[model samples]
Target: MDLHPIEIVGRHPGPKILILAGIHGDEYEPIAAVRRLAGQIDREQLTGKVTLVPIANHSAYLRHSRVGTDQLDLARTFPGSADGTPTQQVAHAITGLIQQSDLMIDLHTGGLAMEISPLVGYMLVSDPSTLQKQRQMATAFGLPIVWGTTASLPGRSLSAARDANVPAIYAEWGGGGGCQAAGVAAYTAGCLQVMAQCEMLPSPAAAAPVDRCVIEDDRDTSGHLQLNYPAPHAGFYEPTLPLDSTVRPGDELGRLHDPFTSHTTTIYSTQTGRLFTRRVLPPVEAGDCLAVILEDPAETGTTNE
Candidate 1:
């Protein structure tokens, strides 16, 4: 695995912030954002080091697919074995880089199949202090939403960082394998804000006020805001609502139609939230994720409006 590490060292020593992108090859907004940022930074004015990996999964990036040539997802192979598959090797190298950073940000999007809204997320750690650190970083990223999950699932890039006790956040915005100007600009600006927050660079004169929505894991309750809607059966999907559309419970999300059987099923929203993700591909398979519903922060009383 060939790792492209773009490092910018400042005149004065400070925290090291690592920004990673292209973990999923089909997501291009973050890669472009990071590359643009790398070109704009003035090293002489910077106080710390900044490392940017514009394309984390080179093979998948070339193919414009989520998985690499080895038929593996790089995001799920963190803390990987030294002698392992190609994806695993890449994961190991990425983990090593995370270990060397004071703060980290993993950039992601919905990829080829779906579109996503801009959001920042951190992993829920065992220690209160560590979790607090993660929260601060996520909040500082200036995204409207901040989500925290308990434990990193095996092989996830953030899992390695969590295990290392590093403060990190994952950012998602834009998707469908195409670049959006707004998405790229938002990501680039957000990266700069994070660097300023880390004290790696001077703070901007007027930082944008973030209307934050905090999502925490509470599995025991039905009020959990983050929700995933999977394909009920294999068919062609046609979404009823646009991405980022606000909805109430019982709202029709889309329809899944079986061409061969002439059967149609309507997908409905179970809770009040924003439609952050929706599958763009017409072909679907049973158990495939079709849409992601995020509970409205106002309804959940988690909004900083």
Candidate 2:
């Protein structure tokens, strides 16, 4: 209940948007971008307020790994108990923040294990109005990939927003190491563009990418990025495909060389699409996600025209 959020109040009245980052500790770009934004807003020319949670899960952040010392992933423990584990308490506090917001943007990166192409994604909620708002927000964020996926997944910050009837979106960018400067700058500009779209800031519409690929997939696991390309054995993963590479079904995604033996297992792409994510961390467990090949929307019949 003692979550400290940065509040930037505008002189005028408009929509109060909540911008969140650091839901996972290892993802640094969002946290840095949020901090930068705290100092960049011009209250004199703005409307409404911006509430920023630069580090939503301090517990996880302190550990320097994806999960906290309690080994709970804050992203998957949302709307948590008031008196639960530290990560759960953080989730509960963020849920409260989401409930009081008119708009929400949760930012993330691939963390230490994965690299992701820059993208803005939203849940494919049932409400048409919310969905439209989300689509607009994602567009305004101006990422190369605008993704709309199934909303049935629970325990996420977006799910909490959905329950509170608030339109929300999240952004992801390059990762698998320390925060990249490009990722930080991109996130800052993206947040400002979203604010402009919400009438909280004075700026022209964010320039839409000339080659943007907008996708709307309702498959139950469309948004589940970590559930793909599981390692056949716990070994050192050597990914063959790079991020955003055009991948064909049956193409080798990567190889897992047995850490204890000379055997290597080659993982193949299951769908024809782009390689949206690749594992940068070599040490992998049997079930660790090695890569995530975003299925081609054309094949899935889920393209946004």
Candidate 3:
């Protein structure tokens, strides 16, 4: 779990920015995006050091799964131990890198399990300056959505950033395995945009569109995508509505059918918002999160950097 990161240093001194990908091995877009960034970004065009970890979890990637051979989620084992399992060692190393940097951008996708809309997110931390920087980075990412959620969750790279007082943000794109060209391109430009926004790049990156959706929720469960729309029974799930569509309460999300028992159950939405996440894989266990509604958000309007 060495987590060998690529470091690009700028001619001039500036912030040390860390950009990570492949926290979950099945998420392919981020890995490709980071690799693209490494080739595109030149030290002469940058004002600070940019560290890129294209494949943060090699063990899982080798197995073509989300978790490592140790069966531990690297995302949930942050600030991990040097004397622990492989995933824990990887987490510990990444957390050390996060603490050593001034800013961070952790890229992600839904992996092989679900499909997620392209969006950038940050924790709703108590520090105003850090929160503001996070917002700036999210806007600069030039994605369709900007999500600010609760900062209380533990065992994450963002949590390590929160504790280290380092400004950080994560981006999610469409996922269901394989590298989506659009997602890779967006992520590549997004990282450069963030560098420009932070004055690390000489050229100004493309500005985010006027109508980009911005949602900030500080509730305890704001960004937990795994808790929405639980399946009634273990079965094959088929979603009704498409991803990125708005849904009101009672809207049918999907159907669950117990393959052996032939029992079918239709799942409905419990909240109103965009359907940001929906399980793409058919088989699911009882209580597995089937759909995730973003919860109707009163637009925060165009956020300034």
Candidate 4:
């Protein structure tokens, strides 16, 4: 297999932390943040190694879609097959890097139709050892919000590293697509802090503690989300709480209907939690998703404040 060239700007030594971004391709914030971080890294601060693969999925990135050219989710094709499709080849290359890594931080962002907070995402595995390491890495970043994913078991993107006994965590921020200024800053700072934790950099800035929440892996945990704002009939969508609000069942999140005909329909939260994502464009179809609940705070520990 031809090795994908990963750029390095650190001194030769110490622990190695692999910062991978763009597994999904269209998630622009992570790629942008990596670019910004790469430009500012001091190679002399010398200690451990820091290797960055800012764009892992070249085809998906080029197409501006989540899936690669083969319509395969690159994140799921771990320890990939060399003789398989192109997506698998890319996955194999990434897995090789992770195998040699001491720690890893996969950067990500919400995609297509939803936005997620600038938070650290760690898979909540049942394995005691894995869980412990995940927690340690989660706390190390110190972002204001930590999101745990209980789904996508041991064969996904970072799974190879975790299986190899490496401590890795995924960091996410900004979204619907493109680099949001604040999100870029948050991710860059968090990434550096993680590198410092591994001694890849000296005296990296302190990371602010973020609220921790579990994004339950269930029938609803989707890699690419589509939030449909349905209209009871058809009209302009007038929203009340912008996307990503802490809401409760029966709480009116927005209203939709005929603005010209005066036919109004109120959108209510189906679950109690924060509204982390929604449709940016207004207007809706009958029975469409007005908004989505990220987690039910009481059971999930998510907070909007």
**Clash count per candidate:** 1, 0, 1, 9
Best by TM-score: 2
Question: lDDT, candidate 1, residue 89?
Answer: 91
Task: Please report how far candidate 1 places residue 251 from its true position, in Å.
Answer: 2.2
Query: What clash pairs does model 1 have?
Result: 76-155
The residue-by-residue lDDT of candidate 1 on 1-305, one tens digit each, is: 56878999999999898899999899999999989989988999999899999999999999989899899988878887678988889998999999998888898888888877788887767878878878877877788878776573567777888888888888888677679898888888888877887787888667668788787753332222223788888999999999888988799999999999979999999878778778888898887778888764445764322
Cα deviation in Å at residue 104, candidate 1? 0.4
* TM-scores of all candidate predictions against the true structure: 0.90, 0.96, 0.95, 0.77
TM-score of candidate 1 relative to the true fold: 0.90
Which is the better candidate, 2 or 4, if ranked by TM-score? 2
Ranking by TM-score: 2, 3, 1, 4
Model 3 Cα lDDT, one tens digit per residue, 30-87: 9999999999998988898999998999999998888999999899898899999999
Candidates' lDDT values, in order?
A: 0.82, 0.89, 0.89, 0.70
lDDT of 2 by residue, 1-305 (tens): 66689999999888989999989899999999999999999999889989999888787888888998889998899899989988888899899989999999999999998899999999999899999999999998988999889899888999999999899999999988798999999999999999998889998553655579998888888898878877777889888877889988799988889877889888998788889889999998888888887775667676544
Per-residue C-alpha lDDT of model 4 across residues 65-142, encoded as one tens digit per residue: 878889988877887888899889988888888888877888887666445565676765657776776777776776
Tell me which of candidates 3 and 4 scores higher on TM-score. Answer: 3
- What would the TM-score be for candidate 2 when compared with the true structure? 0.96
